[model samples]
Target: MRLVLLSLLLVLAGCQAPASNQASQPKVPTFYNHWELFAIDAVKVPRLKPAQRLDVDRNYMVSGMAGCNRVFGQGKFEAGVLTFENLSTTMKICPAELDRYEQSITEVLSNDPKVTMYRGDLVLRANHRVLQYRLVKETSSQ
Candidate 1:
């Protein structure tokens, strides 16, 4: 009886793959909270009002911005590399600093994803765990 029970347990365990063995999202190199500023780009700066579900689509990982209209830009996330083409924001009137904050958001869209002051860097997972993006803007001088 002991031998039969041991064999059955072993078979059950084998049938169920180990947690570590389960296929999971790809891992990135590392994460950083803040990124250095660089020249802003004219072409890539996304429109003021982003009317899209930025996070749902595996297309990109994004978050930030308040209401739909008069939206204040927050942050964005991307896997591998980031792009300014995709941004979701509400259109809400904001103060000067918030407006400028939105501009900065556009600038960093290429440098690195919006970072948490305390969190440092955001973790980009295929699912809910927000993704990271790297923005590369083209200077207007060109």
Candidate 2:
């Protein structure tokens, strides 16, 4: 009787599910398909509101408004890094500050930057400068 009881207890213990390690691991956040620039290097661009945005399409093409001009480029995102290449922007005249802002954005994009998504915002860091963007939710148009 004693032996049978011991065997039954062992079998029950073996049948119990093991603790899962997956629950302890952190999950990576997914990048948004569209983002609008909210700030650059912790300072907001006052006049260029909603004029700078980033759209990552299905083809990995990056297109958006940089200040007053339309900018397009090939972009790749992998392993939390983003690289933009073959960038070309429309030649449009704008204010000196806007032109400077556009130039800064172009330079940063050209350099491969580390991408981070935090608190519902997209951040790109390169050469000690940070570009912050907010996720743009798409609405259905009838």
The top-ranked prediction according to TM-score is 2
Give the worst 10-residue stretch by lDDT in candidate 2.
17-26
TM-score of each: 0.31, 0.71
Model 2 spans > 4 angstroms off: 1-28, 47-50, 139-142
In candidate 1, stretches whose alpha carbon ends up further than 4 angstroms from where it belongs are 1-6, 23-85, 88-95, 110-142
RMSD of each: 13.3, 5.1
Per-residue lDDT of model 1, residues 53-96, tens digit only:
12222323444442232222233344554444545455667666
What tens-digit string does per-residue lDDT give for candidate 2 at 1-142?
9999999999877766343455665565455477788888988756465468887665568888887788888877777677865778899897887787787777777778788877888788888888888877642320
Clashing pairs in 2: none
Residue 87 Cα positional deviation in candidate 1, in Å, after optimal superposition: 2.8
